[model samples]
Target: MHGIEIAVSTVIFALRDDPRNDCTALGMPLVRRVRQPYEGSWALPGGPVRPDEDLTDTARRTLVETTALSPTYLEQLYTFGHVDRASKPVPGPRVISVVYWALVRPEEAERGIEDDNVAWHAADHPPELAFDHATIVDYALWRLRTKMEYSRIAQAFLGETFTLAQLRQVYEVVLQRTLDPANFRRQVESSGGVEPTGEYLVGGRHRPPKLYRHRAASDLADNGPLTRL
Candidate 1:
């Protein structure tokens, strides 16, 4: 079944909601397909895998070709193989698609949107997608929300030196809920994913919020399971 195979793709995100503190909401680069099947329709930036390429490399290449973005944090999200994942009237397989999710800094990703039709949409909301992408998007969003609750994912979506208020916004956008400032700050401190850099923001109107940075990947426990629910 080598000829009848599928490939992996990613839904990469970067936070861009920081005008107040120079932060920005989370954004994902989307492409308007130029070829057939779903031509002119919007889709996640990705493509088929070459015979010799590894899946992750394929995902990365597709990201470059479609969106010009580099993924700072990439991981396999899930496999989607519904019977009609594709809409080809011709010949195509069952169209099994391995989905991945990635995160990058917003400033770095802004340069990735090349096409006039290609645009950065909020990671929380997007236009009507092609094929079974809607379902894939739902699954990816669920994974992101659940994983952020128990994993060190907040850093992947934020800058190294971020204020507590900025970090809270990441949770708010992804979880689609407002978090109490006191509770969120306490929880982040207790989780140990971030540590203060002995700096305070001075420009904001209210009390200066402390600045913190994300922990390096090596700091987290990597021996066994990586879930926290």
Candidate 2:
């Protein structure tokens, strides 16, 4: 009897300019496979987990090797081990995939483009993926949008100091909706998720906007059990 094969994958998201729409969109990098079972198809960056490494380490190493990325916010998203998930014929034990999700700033994400067979695709409209990666991306997106409503996860997409408008844009892009400036400001202040940095963003048409930084991680909304890892 064949033993189960363990694998690791990661969905690393960043806000990037989508030339197709000429707007910034949430996207992640995908690598095109060269071998069969789903050759030439785009999929998340990952590979088989080594026995000597932990799951998280495997996820991190695969991401860096495939896209040269080191995400600022990395957390375990889910484990998928359906009996029929892999395209390979049965009789062999199922393949188990431990999926992780991460967030990185746009500038940092660009560095990943240097890798071969890797390219960024908008998360909301990814191409057909190999295996069940399409479903995995959708689930990762759901977790991201849901987390934005409560936690300061959005901060991972921005620099150390950012204006309220900039922060609001991150939400608008992920949530796919516009927000009232006054209301968003009030809500964020009341939530104490951010604090003024005593700095301001200049060079825009309007008055300079004050910049803010995220509160300490411990003070932010709980990210469930992953925060303790």
Candidate 3:
């Protein structure tokens, strides 16, 4: 029996606040492969796991090396080990990918564009990706959308202190719909996921909205069984 080759991949998402577009949209960086199997194809940033490093560490390292991004939120997404997942036909061993999803600020995502091989693409409508990366990104987006309903994961996309409008924009972008500002504010306040920072965003055309920050982790809803991991 052949041993399975383990690898790590990360789907790093950022909310691009485009002035022309009313709502922000999710974007992620994809790297163009320079080697065989899927040479010149766009794919998630990843690498084979080292024998000594833990899976999460490998995920972080691969992300940094490929995109130079250190996301504020990183979590194990899912594992894919399908027999035909690899683009190349290898006779030795099947490959298994431990995928992770990360959330970084828009500025960080923009900085990553310095790499010619790495470019940000819309998460909802990415071009054809190598291997099973397209499917992996879709699943990761689904996870993010679902988690936004309960967990305070949306805060990860924002800075330390942000206006309610900015916070709501994160939700609108990820959820792919406009939320009723009044109702959305009520729901979030009732959930106790955020608290006012006694600050305000000034100098905007509109009235200054109060700045808020996510509450302590314990105050947020538990992400079911996965939270422990």
Candidate 4:
């Protein structure tokens, strides 16, 4: 047995053009490890937690250092620390990772650095990953889809103003299902999570669609009681 080491990793989700589907799909960035235990394998962006640095700040820093992305919506997801989690013959102290998940707007996501070492992959069908990152990504996807059912978190993927159709598309792409346009519109309007911007989208051939934005006073999503602390 050896001393425990704390680390921070982030799963950043974004909507990107899925050439396979010719539409927007959920994607995430992975950085190729330059050193073993799994050198050359892609893994979530992260690093050893520096002394005196907060967990959230460390999570943000890892994203910037690896991917150059700074998403606005970030939340602590869960901690992963199993004695056998990395049972492979690795020469290092046991690592316990505090994981976070984030959502980024399309424009912001496009700015992420994508070189040979860092690249975006389709979240649902990601390639081989190092350690237990595959499991971590599954958990993050579950949490995101669960929250989308009852929260305005979907707005995190859109611009400040969007049409109802645009908002619904986000849910559909993430949830992997189709939502009734009428029902979705009615629910969103009644949910008090968004407000009309009093402006309509231009450049469309059909009648302009009224633009809406998340209510300024509302949090993207209800984070439970811990948010109050």
Q: Which candidate achieves the best TM-score against the true structure?
A: 4
The ten-residue window of minimal lDDT in model 2 covers 217-226
Tell me the tens digit of each residue's lDDT in model 4 across 1-229.
3688889999999999866768988999999889888889999999989998999999989888888888869999999998756656675667899999988889988765767899999999998899999999999999999988877799999999999999999999999999999999999998999999999998855889999988888787457896686
Superposed on all Cα atoms, the candidates' RMSDs to the truth, in angstroms, are: 4.0, 2.2, 2.6, 1.8
List per-prediction Cα lDDT, in the order shown. Answer: 0.76, 0.86, 0.84, 0.89
List the candidates ranked by TM-score, beginning with the highest.
4, 2, 3, 1
Model 2 ranges with Cα > 4 A deviation: 88-93, 204-206, 217-229
lDDT (10s digit) by residue, model 1, range 1-229: 4544587768877877545666456677788878777788888877777889988788988887777777668777888876656745544566678888888875687555657978887666788887778778778888788878788776777666889888888788777788999998899899877888998876856878788887664332222554331
Roughly what TM-score does model 3 have, to 2 decimal places? 0.90
Record all residue pairs in model 4 with backbone atoms less than 3 Å apart, i.e. clashing: none
RMSD of 2: 2.2
Report the lDDT tens digits of candidate 2 across residue range 26-134: 9889999997667888999999999899998999999889888888888889999998888453234478999999888877976557867999988999988988899
Candidate 1 lDDT at 173 equals: 75
TM-scores of all candidate predictions against the true structure: 0.84, 0.91, 0.90, 0.93
Indicate whether candidate 1 or candidate 4 has the larger lDDT.
4
What is the overall TM-score of model 2 with all chains considered together? 0.91
